[model samples]
Target: MRLNQYIAHHTKYSRREADKLIESGRVNIEKTKATLQSVLQEGASVFIDGKRIVPKEQFTCIVYHKQKGELVSKSDERGRRVIYDSLESRFKHFVYVGRLDFASEGLLILTDSTPVAKALMESHLERTYLIKIDGEVTKEMINAMEEGLVSEDARVGGHSKSEIVAMEFAAFAYYEILKNDKKYSKLKVSITEGKNRELRRFFGVFGREVLDLRRIAYGFVNLNALPCGKKRYFTKEEYKSLHTFLKEHSTKESKKIESRH
Candidate 1:
């Protein structure tokens, strides 16, 4: 891994922050100034600001039931409450696996290992959600959910300030209509991709507003009976499953690298 990645995986600083530290002449490898492109050597000592870094052999992972109004960030400049405010200080340095928008709530995974977080985020794991929409479930929506949709302008249901315009929505992995009525409609949906405001944008295309959205599960992790704004450690089975997943992911990544070479 690069110097910044090595620092981020072993320390509380993010990759960007690690880059800044290296540029400022703070990071060192065996007393030699570390550069941005420096690759970590196995069994080599690393230091930042004169303090030696000892990488942990084991990493911890946790799941949090994020509330509807909380932002998945360290700090918001606008004074809005963030997930860290509700989460314990001990987890302040953990990296989140994926994001849930301010209006959306549900199971969120955080881990001390940046590698684990990045691997899970990049994988095509299914995320299941229970969503309620403001209008009836139309045939157009059903067809789109079944066959996928491409939008030239996909800014409708996204953040008002988001610059992303064009988006292609993959066909939902699975969907089941739970309730359909004139007042509102509810559905259970599963998708493999975690695109930006994807569910909202998909519904927005059909002129339907998502009134409520909550993720119930991600891969092997599930919210179960966890209350809002609370957190819990991974179960024994969950840990086992995570270990298997990480192993397979590492193998696949290595294969990709070898193919490239």
Candidate 2:
């Protein structure tokens, strides 16, 4: 494991924070100051703030962009294109953190840790999307989104209540109109929940047609500089940020749930 990952996995500090501590000369391996590229090898002693950082299970994380129409299944029944086809054969055991429907595209996380995925999904980890929809995206529409929407289909999700069952309405952390050509406009929306085809249905409430949709960010990890159909291992900083976000979100969620009762 890398030094930063080691600190993050075994300690509450995130990978980015570990990097700062290391650069500030607070971390040491065998009494030598550690660098970002420093590796934690067997029988090596690592100390941060005069305390030892015990090594934990080394985890591997990958961020991949799912190309549209590339099915997310392990294997297609009829042999259609799938996301795994683009990944290295060695990563066959890894499971995707979340599902992106066949028609949807953008940042996807592949990892062997089920606990990590569960923690994130149960929390309010934010997902950001860049979507291009037909027709003008007006201020009124944005205001409606922020207030939330009641989907026509309750089986999927909505906020309406009548017979004692109430569903969550899709809400946004922020919405930005990136481009507006009148006929077609590009938008950036950040959402906290992963409702099934929520964006499509959310826009449908306004009678808009979604042309293109892509996830640009998840939590603190950004899908930058990576092309479609390619995968890369998480750097120490990214790994740390992922863990930090999960921990903070999990704590906040548990508190919210407890307060409700």
* Every model's TM-score: 0.83, 0.68
What shift in Å separates residue 135 of candidate 1 from its native position after superposition?
1.5
TM-score of 2: 0.68
Report the C-alpha lDDT of model 2 over 147-170, residue by residue, as the tens digit: 976644443222233242323466
Off by over 4 Å in 1: 1-55
Which candidate has the top score in TM-score?
Answer: 1
Candidate 1 per-residue C-alpha lDDT over 125-162 given as tens digits, one digit per residue, 9 for 90 to 100: 99999999987998998999999999988888999999
Q: Clash pairs of candidate 1?
A: none
Residue 66's lDDT within candidate 1 is 96
